[model samples]
Target: MADNDVSQLSASQQQALEQFTAVTAQETKDAIPLLRRSQWNVELAIAKLFDGEAADPVVEAAERAAAPAAARPQIPPPSPLPTPGPSLGAGSRNRVTISPAPRIVPQPTAVSRRPSLLISLLLFPFSLVWRLSNSFASLFYTLFPFLARFRTATSPPSRTQTTRRSQNPRDTAARFIRLFEEEYGTDTGLEFFEGGYAQALDLAKNELRFLLVVLQSDEHDDTASFNRETLINPEVVEFIKTQNIILWAGSVQDSEAYQVSAGLGCTKFPFAALISRAPSSTSNSQGMSVVSRIVGPTPPQTLVLKLTTAITTHSEALERIRATRAVHEAGRAILEQQNSAYELSLARDREITRARREAAERRAREEEFARAKAEEKVLLAKNRIAWRQWRATTIPKEEPVGKDTARVSIRLRNGKRVTRRFNGGASMEEVYAFVECLEYLDESATDEETPERPGGYAHEYGFKLVSPMPRQVYELRSEKDGSERTVKDCLWPTASLVVEVDDGEDNEEGEDN
Candidate 1:
């Protein structure tokens, strides 16, 4: 290319041209056309140069004209024409000749009638035998599953578009590779990936690598040479390995391989394709696309050239996609962390609210219990005062005036002495009550001043009167029983008694002893 024309190209295109000219050792003017034809692919341009497609016919003719005459290739002489033959005699020899008429051939008539009964009966035994044989074969296959493989092997080949059988793609791929290696030998440097075609595509897309699919047809004449020479060539194998391409090859005889070939629109045997992530313009629905196709047999250099061109063109786009994915992943992780923290804070708030509610309820219950207990104590005190006032009124103003009158002298619990006279019919409880109401006995003691007994209350004296001479005790019974011993029963006539507090200490001491 001219210097001015080269400057008009982009930086990448100019670089590609320079590399192309350097490798092919061709003049800039001569290399531009080849590079343009290969879309500025240096590898492809170099391949075209070595194939002699870059030669100029005008220049070749000029070189031939400048050469000496003796060195030129000799031209062979043209062959002589043949002599004319003698004419045949007429008339005297003209005898009459008869022409034969055309014969009509019978045409076949279409049969629209049903088959005869005799024909059906004649074929009945053969049909029956065929059905029996099929039944026996099916039974055998069912009894021994291993025989199914043999039946498959013996089956006739089906149409290429139709799948023969469904099998595990991994197993199919491994088996194909094993058989390939056995036929081509292990030294074939091309490493075929041992997995299904779909799996290979997924791996290549996720890893941002190129996938090279090599589909071989055993019946094709070019298959053997292609595997032997082009695929195993050192330059081709090294290029594929350096590019980190995922190579997956299979025979067209396999169901998966047949389906792949049909899907990729393979019109020739020994087909190979370079597939990678679809470009941004077409990526909405397509994950991958065929970037380059090499059909029939190709030289190692041409195959490498096609692969290199496709990879170099798409590498930039793949890098951009990878960067976008990393940013999205980082943002998603941060969002998840924030959500988990919020959930923990919400749970802690709920727990604190529950504890406060329980504490408030417990305090309310305790306050209610204390208020009820205080009210009960005040009611009991009032009942005791009312009973004392009532008993005081029942005491006589003076000693009974009768010969059966009894006098008693009692010492109160507060160390005070009290003398009282009771009627002969007075009970022992009367003497006890006389001592109890000694302070309440006054001119003001009256029935109107006394209050009713406390509801559900049973009053008992806290002290008992004891006889000093014989140590006999007079204990008051509960008023609810309404029974009391008379004063004459123990303290008739005259008696000296001491009132002592009836605390439970004596009962505790007795139990301890």
Candidate 2:
């Protein structure tokens, strides 16, 4: 076969050819000829390789050897080997040995095949019954539309439309008025608002007016006479129109009107109730209060007098409530203004306090920086002086041996005497620096050291080093030749240095100057 032709074989075909050659103990050179003759079919080449008579006995022997020893059947005698079949050609006579056949493993069947078909057949009758029942129900509903409501009632209940129907008070009252006019004629002079009882109550509350609710039952014997004689009276009609009142009338025929009548607990027919706004402290439930109620028929003058008295009493009460509310509002305004002023003052105080604290912090930082600089300067000066002393360059040898240095004794204000030996050639500035260092060291040794002060000294007083024995004040001065004198030139071998603290006035003057 061509080299490219071998590459064209599928993976399974190549694997099967390798397994076939291994089982038959055949070389690729000899097997390829046989495989090509069979069109590279691995199973066909395998069958042809074992087709001779010699292979049949070897296969039978392997099968017998592989059987379980206990499962082998007992026989009277062993049968003789079968005679070889007649060979037609040299190729057919070629014997090829092979292993036993591979064991066959059963696979599980798919769930969607037979099982699904059976389930479908089992559920068919139930599905048909359900469809038939639904069809009959639909037919019944179509024939009697009203009966559909019963079926719907078994479902989850929803909000009814009655609430929306009753919301429009004006429409409901207007319809009732039309019905009343059709039944009894419109000759009565009593004017009524086209609204429900709730609307009338709300109007009376907002406008601070009275509400007149008239409930009439058509079955009552006195309803007609009461409306004609008392309600339609000129005096009653005039009072209702002239006074701060809203009249709302309804008949018992309407369901809404009957509900209102039942809620009011009215047993008598031709009932007239005067509703008004109660005092603020008193609870006006449902936004209405029954001020006066007249049951059955009564004279027009008596009804007018009762309405007038109730209106006067309630009007005076409402006026007092208005006055009280006005006073409370004024007090509340004043309190709010006072509280605003207090808050402003508190904010101002906080700002001032914050500024003072920040200033103090800034001063502390500046003092700390200055103290650090002073300490560095002192350390550098000490290093320079020690280097000069070690080099023996600043010592004056011209003076007498023992008198080469000056012994200066200083007396402090606290009655403490401090004496130290200094170089005779040292300048007066050195003498002052030594005194300042001594005072700083002394203050540090004490417990009452004030670190918040700007400088190392406790007091703000200036110091003047003087010689009391010579009666002369020592001052630093630059000569014309640009040369300054030292402590040795002023007070030779020994001198008494008295440190005098300046008074407040002298210190202030020195600062000013």
- Per-model TM-score, in order, reads 0.45, 0.31
Per residue, candidate 2 scores C-alpha lDDT tens digits across 1-513 of 342254676787577668657655677655655564455776566556543212346644664787665664432121222333333242122211111111112122224444487787998999899999989988987899877544332322122212323334566688767776775678666568877676676777766677888887654556778877888888988889898578888765554555666666566777877776554324334444666667777889989887776665456545544544554566688899999999999999999999999999999999999999999767655554343232232222223346667787888656678777777777876666555444344334453533332233222225778888767777655454557668788766888988876565232211111
RMSD per candidate (Å) reads: 24.2, 40.9
Off by over 4 Å in 2: 1-168, 182-189, 280-287, 324-513
Whose lDDT is greatest here? 1
Question: Native-vs-model 2 lDDT?
Answer: 0.61
Q: For each candidate, what is the lDDT?
A: 0.67, 0.61
Task: Write model 1 residue lDDT over 400-493, tens digit each, in one string.
Answer: 5577777888876656677777887766777776666666676336435554444666777767789987888865543556677777766788
Residue 327 C-alpha lDDT in model 1: 42
TM-score of 1: 0.45
Return the clash pairs for model 2, or none: none
